[model samples]
Target: MKRPITTLFMLMSIDGKITSGDSDELDSDKDWKTIVGVKEGIGQYYDLEQCTDLWSLNSGRVMEKVGMNDKAVAQFKSPVSFVIIDNKPHLNEKGILHLCSWLKQLVIVTTNKNHPAYAMNLDNLSILYQEKFDGEKLLDELASNYKVDRLTIQSGGSMNGYFLRHKCFDYLDIVIAPLLVGGKDTTSLIDGESITSSNQLHLLSSCRLIEAQTLENSFVRLRYEVLK
Candidate 1:
């Protein structure tokens, strides 16, 4: 049915350098602050406390952190139903089982059921085992079951790549922080092959949300439409 999704990205480094080529410099507090501020701002814009059909797609790593971190867990507990995607489905149970308590309908997307961790949480969580991972099909299932019209994609790199490659994103909300982390092996904000000139995104709008309250020190929010 071709459901539209909004992809939200929190990227580190002002120069678009998540990590440098050389694996030396790591851990930048300034960058982290910017990221947190942006999160807070986003939280304000949307009613996260209310239970709605809003669906969130996260990477495996994010799922683990969000499941454990009190703040993260609470954020998911609000209105949005979370769908965490991982190539290895087992990791979802092994790491982030507790946060499942917060989620109304916790969905895990994985390729196969090959790990011992997968067996433990069959009763507690909803598992969607796919022979092949297809984002479009996943969306169809979500809209059917959860009644979600608008979807958001939170990055964990490879998951972002899958959606990007499939041209599944409708809008992109990029929060760029003003800091740099210089290292080669550092995690990327998103993982995707170079989208060619033909696939470049078109700028829809760009605006700054001035941070009057909380950690946000006035961040720039850019919106783009993926030119599919």
Candidate 2:
């Protein structure tokens, strides 16, 4: 069965600048603890317990660059699986093995593995790999593996843009916090093409939360629907 693509986005500022008139760059850390907690809340609100067979969609390059490297495994979701897009021929075996075991539902989208590196590194993990490179096909394969009718996009930036541009995302949730980041090289919580096609989004809900006890501040959570 085919499932509708759902995307969720959460953004936090260094000084709770959700309505700041000026555009400020993001800071390092990106307030991950709060972000993870919000994601957990979303999973609970969505009652993922009834749909435990769902898998998360993400980019393999970003996963290798950040997900595996993070020392404190952010508590985002409970026992959720993932479907990642990675077609690199030189990917290491150790990384794939680690991710496959960690994620509940793991699938890799890649082209033919005919390279020397792939041949040598292919192992038990290779069994979960697929050969489709497009976003639509990737989602279909994920639905086949898990009975997913929705998707939540945890950003690394580029992957988010690709999915949104393809109109594969059907929902967006933004968590705004109080902070100002004047950093030069940092990135905002969300960035993408101007969405040339007229797409209407309806507001699903809004809530507020005290994000961090250590920091002692509140944040606004806004959920938007990418009209079907």
Candidate 3:
């Protein structure tokens, strides 16, 4: 049960939708700006520069949503290590290489044992293993090997749901924008296998709201601590 202090940081619409649709863009530019502003606030509040790990489940979609093009990617610099969770290692070698070029370290989490034996052999690349995407095991390895105390999970919905279902997340930092993108295909804040009746989250039992604030941009930031 040993794991790092994991936090889920996400931006969602008023209706709790994470993405507009299949597209890798938010509802509007203002929403995107609001997310960035909240992230900056988080950085200041938490002194995030000292954090060693930045995690994401969907790298391509996240990069596109954040408007990280090739030029932006090239100039991107961070002291924190980048950890990507991909069960199948679906990302192309070129893209992985590109990110490894800029990041301090690029760690790929995959269930596939042969992932590291592939063609790309970047300097700061490391491969970690987890069977069937075990969230707790992954975090334990991160905490023990990488010394990632405050790990951030900035990702799409399914991964968020995975961590929540596994009860591996300690903090949930959500920024709710003042807009709603309603569509059947729209992704929600947590999208994964349905939790059974026995395992559903109960208020004040599994989690508790610690902070709630309304930003100047009409966005509401809510922080919740998962009680173990």
Candidate that scores best on lDDT: 3
Q: Itemize residue pairs with steric clashes in candidate 3.
A: none
Order the candidates by TM-score, highest first — what do you get? 3, 1, 2
lDDT of each: 0.55, 0.50, 0.66
- Which residue pairs of candidate 2 clash? 14-179, 15-178, 15-179, 15-180, 16-177, 16-178, 16-179, 81-105
Tens-digit lDDT track for model 2 on 145-205? 5567767666455556566656676666655544454443344454444444435332122
TM-score of 2: 0.59
> Alpha carbon lDDT of residue 108, candidate 2?
59
TM-scores of all predicted structures: 0.66, 0.59, 0.76
Give candidate 1's error at residue 17 in angstroms: 5.1
Q: Which candidate is the best by TM-score?
A: 3
lDDT of 3: 0.66
Angstrom error at residue 169, model 2: 1.5
